[model samples]
Target chain A: MVLEATLRGIRLVGDRTLRIVERIGATVAFLVMTLVHSATSFRRFDLVIREIFFAGVQSLIIILVSGLFVGMVLGLQGHETLQNYGSEQSVGVLVALSLVRELGPVVAALLFASRAGSAITAEIGLMKATEQLSAMEMMAINPIARVVAPRFWGGVISMPLLAMLFSAMGIIGGFLVAVVLIGVDDGAFWSQMQAAVDFRHDIVNGIIKSLVFGVAVSAIATFEGYEAPPTAEGVSGATTRTVVSSSLAILALDLVLTAFMLKGWN
Target chain B: MERSTLNLWVGVFVLLGFFAFLVLAFKVGNLSAGGNGTTYTLIAHFDNIGQLKERAPVRSAGVLVGRVKSVRFDPVHYNAEVQMAIDTKFPFPKDTSASVLTSGILGEQYIGLDAGGDEKMLKDGDEIKLVQGAVVLERLIGQFLFNKAQDSGADKGAQK
Candidate 1:
């Protein structure tokens, strides 16, 4: 009986693994379809523009506040550490490098996933639960094109913008705490930052990172929502999954991208 | 939301995002063209570059006067060749010495120039003859430790 139970448990694990693999395949296929549809659907333009407002403008205040706090903390920490080495003036370099290279994209994406990503998943999941998706399908209107594509595109566009704003605010916040509050030289802060941070290498890579994250997060959110079971519990579960999975994906992708981008610096 | 209201918000959002992009590119990233004046090229060679990257600032007396354009290895001289672009506004003598310097303990490296007393002004394509390579901290620490060990050995011998 014990041997039989062990075989049964192994079978269950294998079956669960196959199901997960199948789900990932389906999600990727749906994402590809949504992308192709959105590429052509821009001619409608109205849907995309409206969705952009929802995705970007709605998230701005949170991004700004979080960015400011993060930057100020960086400044305080950077100043103290650098002062010990008689390099207090290099606070700007430290702040800018940390924000642009890592913190900016990663923090903004986590915030985005928690905020807009969750909302998209919930909205779509509810529509599915309420049979609105099926009703649209009955009318020969493609729900994926009409609903999911615009949101996917909107998210893709908004993520980089949000990250840029975050980094910009963070730099200013670092300046305030380091120079004004902590008494580091203002000239040294800005000058050292300008000297160290390169447009093509640091800033461009940050933008690219955010853009790729936007695609991944949005795709996962929409896929989870679309595939959710037609029930209230299913909708809530899908929303939770969107947040958890997207956050994990963001960090994983960040590591891979950083390895690729900074391959030569050493 | 109405299309017009949506359009307006989106327009504002795009404008803000664009402004942020400009700040990143020009202010933080320093992608802006050198103001009003043109830049001319100068070259220097170093024995080791030590994390010196392209677009690193070329400064003189704590003032940014130029930037490193490119870095290449000179197989013939067995050294690294660094090409720099100096803004025309900040002219220096041909005898100026250039060194790769770090901003802080672990900060990025930049080219620092010390003005020399010379009658001839540095012109386009001129080579800065005096060049100092990057100071690698690990090597310095290693040398310090080796010296300390030797000194301790000598002290022990003297006691014996």
Candidate 2:
């Protein structure tokens, strides 16, 4: 009897786990559909505007500060190493390449994910826990459209803007370090950069990567939020999942994009 | 309503900032819109074209006069062919020497032109002779290692 009961309990747990997974998958599909439909929802202008503001404009300060510091550090380290070998003019290329290729997208995504991802997860989780989602359904409103779409659009727009801001600030930061700290000639820095850097491909790649990151972060966050169970524990779990999953997705996407971008270089 | 209005303003501002930054990048960085300017082509043949990329700058007296338009290997001659575009204003004299130069100890290689004393200017398509090839970094590193090994050997011999 004891063995039979244990087996029954295990089966029940396994069934419950499968149900949760199915629900999560369903939520993701629903989110994607909602996002697609949002393209036609002209009435959601307020929501879209609010999201752009919250995600992009308000987040600029942090992105700028962090980007500046990152650039400064890169310049300081790169300058020291390059100086040891008597090749200081290449600092411009190093700063520009690193900022455009890696730092801009990755740093912006990580920052946005940490700040907005957790907030989105918690807000949606709380809504679910409090039965607000059910209330929206009862009122004949689409919760995904009303709630998730705005945040998703906001993230998609904000991430790329944040990345551009980061790259700009990073370049300035590197310039400051090179000119003031390292005593590299201002003319040389600008001239060398002008000659070496190509804006068309590198800047476009950074922006494209940022857009992809934004989509990933928003989708992951919304998925985690909408699928949270009706419990406090579930809410916290969703928040954790949103942050972790978004960050990991950003990193993985970065690696893939980097490989594609650098395929012919080697 | 107030929140939405605020959000609108914020969006406008962010858009403005992004555009402004892009303008600044172009102006401050002096990024050339590729293929926009008058270009004269100069070709150089190299036994080895290490770390040379297309669109790399061609410098005269440390000023960028042109850029490497393309790099290809001439299998018949067994030499790397580099095509560069010089600005229309700066006519290259026929005797100019092209040497591959590295920017720093650890930097990308670019072609540097030494203007030769020839009153005759190079035309639309001309090949620069007297090419000084890239400073093979691997060879330099090898030389450093060998020198260090020789110094160590001499020190040990003296001690013995």
Report lDDT (Cα) of residue A263, candidate 1: 80
| Model 2 chain B weakest 10-residue run by lDDT | B27-36
Report the lDDT tens digits of candidate 2 across residue range A103-137: 98999899989888788888888999999999999
Colliding residue pairs in candidate 2: A87-B104, A87-B105
Alpha-carbon runs more than 4 Å astray in model 1? A1-22, A264-266, B33-56, B69-72, B85-160
DockQ of all candidate complexes: 0.54, 0.25
- Model 2 lDDT per residue over B1-160, tens place: 4985776677675775587357435843445544247888888998888899987878899887888999999999998999999889889889999999988766668899999999999988889987987878789899999999999999999999
lDDT of each: 0.90, 0.81
Where is model 2 chain A poorest over a 10-residue stretch in terms of lDDT? Answer: A192-201
Error of 2 at A229 (Å): 1.9
Best by DockQ: 1
* Candidate 2 - chain A - TM: 0.87
Off by over 4 Å in 2: A1-31, A41-43, A79-83, A86-93, A175-184, B1-5, B27-47, B85-107, B113-160
